[model samples]
Target: MKKFRYIVCLLSLATLSSCDSILDKGPLDAFTNDNFWTGEGNVSGYANTFYEQFLGYGNAGGSGDFYFNSLSDDQVGRDFDQYPNNKGVPSSSTTWRNGWIEVRRANIMIEKVSQMTTLDDAARNHWLGVARLMRAWQYYKLVRMYGNVQWVEKSLDITDEGVLYGARDDRDMVMDRVLDDLNFATQNVKDVASKTTWNRSMANAMKAEVCLYEGTFRKYRKSEDSQKAPDGAGATKFLTACKEACAAVMAKGYSLNTSYQGNYNSIDLSKNPEMILYKAYKEGLLMHSLIAYICSSTQISGMSKNAFESYLFTDGKPLALTALNKTDKAPMVDGHLSLKDILAVRDKRLSQTIDGVLLYNGRGYTRYNVGMESTASSGYGICKYDNPAIPEGFRNNTTKNYTHAPLFWLSVVYLNYAEACAELGAITNDDLNKSINLLKDRAGLPRITTAIGFSDPANNHGVSDLIWEIRRERRCELMFDNNVRYWDLVRWHQLDKLDNSKNPDILRGANVANDMSGCKADKVGEYIDGSKASIRAYDKKYYLYPIPSGQIALNPQLAPNNPGWE
Candidate 1:
């Protein structure tokens, strides 16, 4: 439950008023009626409503969409919760992030579609599958945000006190139900040959992600649970499912798009191979201002220097190897080496993902206007998702501009496949070509030989060389999308990077004294002393957001709000 109380409360009041006085009503909300799901177009249109609320397209970098990465070491944002000072600000209201409303809406669609005789069983099931997938994704987010949220499979009436004010379901129970939704979606969703819309492939992509998250999360956060649930999920069971799910996706034939930058910054990705699913933006129709956030003088958000340097060198070596720093000339602009120099000689993604100008596929791209109010909060500016082609006239309004945003792509599937295999130590040489090598091929870096991959320079994740690099690839690959970095950190139990007390590594940006100048201290956060910069506080309870007090006030079953949140 997040800030959705007022909407639900108002609807309940209206229903009660209508029940009390038969003639007091104006026109009631028409969408609630059974006849709405009558036809293919109408049912499809109803399904499309959830698309508007989908977690794709990065949500335009606002406080409302509130990038969860702001809490992780990967990003810095305008929100106080994102600051590095020793403070804990768990959201006071979990109702705002609630998925119950959406779940109810989805359930309505599923219920109405079930009764419709106009459409054939297959057709009806397709719409139902869509609803199921949406519901599952929504519930997954809810469960992730607030553990053991109220699970509603069927739409409940306002008067149904038992289910309306129900006890929160066990997270394991909720996730199992979520998996059931996913299974139904996979069985019923028609296999379409396009990436623009959801289909079996899209559902499979979501399944892979869900399974991966659940597997890794359960593995790392076992401490949160006193006893393992009846469900057989553990490190092995879920990881196997995760690996198989990715294989299912690969069997669908999604390959990496040749240009990684194009995957993020392109105006059109309708035909891109790596693009498994994306939100299209036609000017004056459905567009967004994501680019405006990126091109800003001081981008509202910043990627950490840790995240920035995580990109391996152009020679397929990590920055941890100082030998690469010694012999390999870090590319320099002018005589002096700026942070951009690290980018110039590092992995091609460096040029594609961060600071200054990059020339990719003969297109000249520029970002981080140095003269403006400091480029990035962490010194290293995040230039991802910037579309240079957008006209200046429309840049101010995100709606009027047409910049297609990536939601799901095969590159993630690639990372997923590699990570799962690496996690299980089942990675064969052939698996490399199918997974990590595809990404390496795209980046034009050397493919991992057993000798080079297993060599020294262990990453801070404390995993094996291959697994660490696999994770590093994932971190750099999906940094700005979907708060994947935060999820990854949480799952890997590597929040140590975010622990400012033990080490000041992530708290500080690129350079303590150099990078954060002229920018507002609030935006840049507290760059205390000459060494530590971003000093964010983290408590174990911060892992799960606390359920809102108002919610608990309505239903006491949601009591003992997540460990530290109270």
Candidate 2:
């Protein structure tokens, strides 16, 4: 796969600037339009650029998708809360702009793949599948952000005026096209032996994810903006698609990695059966600072109280109703449950995610105090991506850590299967056995059956007991990975959970003792609070991001910017 690294550089010379430009030109020095598509290797090399563009682990000084939960209810930053405030509208958006650039690149590949006369039928279809898959991924991102974006299937020339300045397509219509591309990819893409590259299994994984999102988004989000499916059969159609996609991936013989912690903290996932697709990082060639972000003394962010309490006890019950609550019996540290005691009664994954020993400024601290020097915003230290075996010198340095990042895995597929079944009101004990129970087994907890009679007092999302449990499993399993929590809230139409005025738990952290140094005695034994001003009250318009004002100005057909941004 190291060849992909160099191929991306070579392909960049042929990449177009945007979708609205004339795409007839080719690289002058390296290759021309006539010669680049002459071989299968060049086609594969052209597709290699999408890997770096779409599935990057992290750059030198940034934690890529690992900490994206900061924008959701799972975590909060130290300087301020991580909620989006009412900033009116933006003049332009790089996400909106860069998305078109990649879309154009993918469209060019799709068009050029048909011109590869030397390749066999199998080879040509494989390249076309790869190109369509990349295009679908970019459009999915666009739809997730700005609801109704123009669906451009081909690389448009400057003479194409209607598509360049046209009204945005309906959400369901564009998603159906995305679904078509995904179906094509799943059928035509060969199953590559390498885990890092795109394949039939990866396409299935992505299809399951995209369908589940669209299904739930339609079921929960209500509006009159023509986002609904035309035939009024939106939720069931996409949820069924999600279910079938999951089943296809499950049949591929992928299993959970025995060590739950090893999934994220591993240096090499090349042979891990759990990983369907991952971003490979070499020690010196491609490394990231995610481990440094986790292990450093810098005040990044930490898990929120809302997220911490979502993990169920070993008996598979919420902490409020569980008999296994150890707050009274466990040893007290600074008037709070000791980290060890907290780990004793709760799910094992919690211990794996957060460090048990408190550290301040890279030194051990016995007291679990909030607002300390090295403690995160919520006082809970995140260690999910930390490899403890790495030397302190390298772990603290930027771009030095090389832990592989999981992009798509079997656990997520399992969760998606369970959720799709539950959402379609077709889940059963058999579904539980095959999906959520496997995760429960890995966490060393009791298996859940459909006969759950107890209702969690903490469940305020208005879902049934079984569906809530399945959602909880997803939250715990995918804690800080790749903005899953935030998008989950969005697709469920539950962004109101981030409002601290109604849900104060989002602003609270670990309880502190009066005697702990630097602790505010008056606020001791109470929720460690964040500033209220940091969170914006939820608005109905927040469901879809506002389209760029500059774009709407350029093309008046994109008027009436999202719901309330007008």
The per-model lDDT (C-alpha) reads 0.64, 0.76
- All models, RMSD in angstroms: 6.0, 5.8
Q: What clash count does candidate 2 reach?
A: 0
| Model 2: how far residue 481 lies from native, Å | 0.9
Model 1 TM-score relative to the real fold: 0.83
Q: Give candidate 2's TM-score.
A: 0.90
Q: Could you give candidate 1's per-residue lDDT for residues 282-340 as a string of tens digits?
A: 77666666666555543455656556567777777766663466222223344222445
Off by over 4 Å in 1: 1-32, 58-69, 78-97, 224-233, 326-341, 357-374, 396-400, 449-458, 511-534
Put down candidate 2 lDDT per residue, 292-353, tens digits, no spaces: 77655666577777888888888778888888764522334653335787687889999998
